[model samples]
Target: MTRISHITATAYSCPFDKQHQLAFGLGSNVKRDVVLVRVTSEEGLVGYGESHHGQHPTAMAEIIERGLAPLLIDCDPLDNEGIWERINRQQLVTHGLGAASMMALSGIDMALWDLKGKLLDQPIYRLLGGTRKKTRAYAGGLALGFLPPDTLQAEVADLLQQGYTAIKMRVGDTPARDAMRVGHIRQTFGDDLDIAVDAATRYSLGDIPEVIRYCEDNRVYWLEEPFTPDNLEAYAELRKRTAIPIAAGENHYGRYAFRSLFEARAISICQADLSKSGGFTELKKIADMASAFHIAMAPHTSHSVLSAAGNAHLLAAIPHGILFEADVAKVNPFRTELAQPPFGVVDGHIEPPHGPGLGIQIDETMLERYPAIAGPCYLPIERSAGPTG
Candidate 1:
């Protein structure tokens, strides 16, 4: 049996020149530091994972190196589920279930899966019962912030021209502003294109009526995160009042959290993040539950290549998988210099990469060039001072 010999973590910062914005937050031009994990077995097999250190790279790294690594040094590398359970059960040092812990576990779990795929000479999706279809994608977080009307129109046109059938725009800038943008996009795209809005937890119950009206009037596909994560009553209320389906779950942590959402009938679409929602293990359970409820899944992705690939595989396995989020922000390594030239985007829809594990071949040398930098590269506008204003 191959026992784990060492677990190593390093951090890298990749700059994004464009300032991306949501209703509640903003990201300035900077190279976000991403924490990478490498697990080496006594038999010399190596598996890699990524922790998307958006605003907490240092903290995530500290937890992985100082806290989680100690637990895995002499353990069996193949016992992924057992190891995850043990870490979850840790009374004092077992904080790897949520936030930094879940982030760290995501990397570790990915590495384990990678190792398993390599050992068996099969792709992770194949090991997970093969794919149902070539994964389809949608434009995600691409058209956000308050841009000039003409500029926003051009962006939507470009995405449509690129062959995207569906696109999500950031809402909650203000109901009036959001209405104007949504109306403009709907008018331009007509009823054929699928358009969705992300309120990003910026709305109150007071804002829901107008927002729901805007979505229905414009034939919007779904409305996401209209209320904060804890406000399930608000979600249920909003769902009852609106014909447009309510979508959420990106901010939610694990299956337990999702069970609450399902029980309340708070969501029609679930946007689970593979990296944050306890990796493949927890996400699989969440997807299964959504299937039972007949809820559609469109996973949230804006982290690293590993997350994108992992989501693609996971989405492939699910019956109700609809669209994958494609970060259309230019100048980010995700769109530019990361991995190989074609990061699997084809005619606006991304096809899953056909290789082992996550099927993402990261450029290690590029990672070395961009050592981990401190602070969040993308700070919310309020945190970014007056420039965003």
Candidate 2:
């Protein structure tokens, strides 16, 4: 019996320079942040998982070390559902920690699954009864933001050359400018290229009609998070106005919120982040639920290769899974240097890791180099544009 012996959530940050910084609907990204969750069992076997920093690495780390670790110590690492329920009942429900609790738990839960896989000497996908297979991927991450049309087109062309047939660009500038960016890509690349746009939960309901007009005219693939996660009505309303698929769920917390998305018939595509949406335990249920409603599954990739590998496994295991968001940010050490064989696109698709657990090896020494930087990863919306004067 492998019992959990110890758990730690260490925060890490990698700052971007002026050359690599990309500004989108949310703000300009200055740094990438992630909480690396490590779980060890009594026998000395170790497993790793990642939690999104939630723009506050220390805060998320504190939640894991101080808030969650006590509850999980001595629990069976193999019993993922049982352990998940224990935390769900104790912290998430009773204390009302909401998304913060869920996000922290996401990492812990992911590590436990990794532990379970290592215990049995199997990959996470095999543990979930999934076969090893490739899933379609798109060029995403912090690149392709609100750049000038020519600059954005050049970025798209580069991703195409890398073998990605599909790409997601950032939007949520003024409606006219946003349309110009979308239209430019479609006109430049023609219809063979698939273009999806993410507004980063930055748009209001009033901003939709015009955006929809351009997306429709340009044959855009989908319009993601045009409004915040809580705005179910806005999503449902937008669906009525446009044929372009509405994709969301990255910021949403658990299956319950996703269940609401189904009941409302709000989105045609679901993009849950495994690191933020309660990890594999909850996300598997969410994926099953999505299958019933006929919604496509495209889990959002986070700051590191851990989530990238885990999401690819989940997508491969599930029947309705459609696309994977490959983080093609120009500079992200967390995705490249921190892990080996860095996650990549092969002919526009990615496959689950074949090694035991989440599979890739990590260099703990890398953590020292990227000690957590204080403050948010994104600059404020106004400051992001810089020098409008």
Candidate 3:
């Protein structure tokens, strides 16, 4: 038995340069933080996974090291479900730290899956019974954000040249400003390109109609997370009024919340994050549930190549997996230097890395080089907006 001999969650941070900084509805992304989970087996096999910082890298790392690791130290690494349930029952459902607990476990669970793949001598997609078919990739992450219309258009042009058929832009600056950006991109690119806008949970229920009008007019692929995940009523209400697909779920945790999203029929697209939504074990269940509801999934990858690679494998494996949110951030070391088999695009589609597990090799040197920076990655900034829900 390859018992979990050791587990550690180490947080790393890489600050953004002035050029690469992305100011969006979520505030400026001055730096990227990730909690890397490394799980060691008795037989010397080590697997790595990433937990989203959730704007608090140090706290997230503490959750893994001080909260979840003790409970999972001796558990079987291959029994992903059993491990998940054990944590859920023992801590998560009890007096555990809610989303933070899930965020911590997410990285650990992903490491377990990585270990499973290595143990079985198979890549994650193959283990999940998914073919290595190429999935469509969208240029996303902390780029294509709030900028002048011409500048945003130029950025979109660069992405198009890079062979991206689709791109997601940040909105919620204001109705007129957002519309101008979207309209400019639409006009410049014509109808062939797929444009998705992420509001980053910044909009109110009152802000829906204007967003929908431009989305419909420009034939936007989807309007994502105009409101926070807990605002189910707002999502449901917007869905009723718009032909544009309402997409969300990156901030949502677990299958239960997703089940509620499904039951409410709040969204036509699911954007679950493997790193935050309970890793591969829970996300697989969420993907299956989404398929039953006839909703297509586009896995969200906001951090390092671990989540990007994990999402690619899971998306390739799932029946209803639709698109891949390729991190197109200009200066993300976590994506560029921290890992390998870079999630590249070919003719605007990305196939899973062919190596065993996540097909990644982390550079430990990068960890030492990019030590975690203290304080919040995104500082709160008040924005002028209409009535909020």
Model 1 C-alpha lDDT per residue in residues 1-389, reported as the tens digit of each score: 77888888877776554454333324334555667778888878787776656476777777778878888888877677888777667722444345667677767777777777766677777777757356667887544556656667788888888888888887776777788888888887688889888887888998777887788999888998988999999999988898898899888877888999999999999998876676776778899999999999998885667777777778777778888888776545644556664475577766666777666676776666676677776555543212222
Computed on alpha carbons, the lDDT of every model, listed in order, comes to 0.75, 0.88, 0.88
Stretches > 4 Å off in candidate 3: 382-389
Error of 1 at 262 (Å): 1.2
Error (Å) of candidate 2 at residue 182 is 1.2
In the range 276-360, model 3's lDDT, one tens digit per residue, is 8999999999999999999999989968888888988998898887889988888878888877544666778888887889877
The C-alpha RMSD in Å for every predicted model, in order, reads 3.1, 1.8, 2.5
A best-first ranking of the candidates according to their lDDT comes to: 2, 3, 1
The clash count for each model shown is: 6, 0, 0
Pairs with steric clashes in candidate 1 = 14-31, 15-31, 26-379, 26-380, 27-378, 96-101
Residue 190 miss distance in model 2 (angstroms): 0.6
RMSD of 1: 3.1
TM-score of each: 0.91, 0.97, 0.97
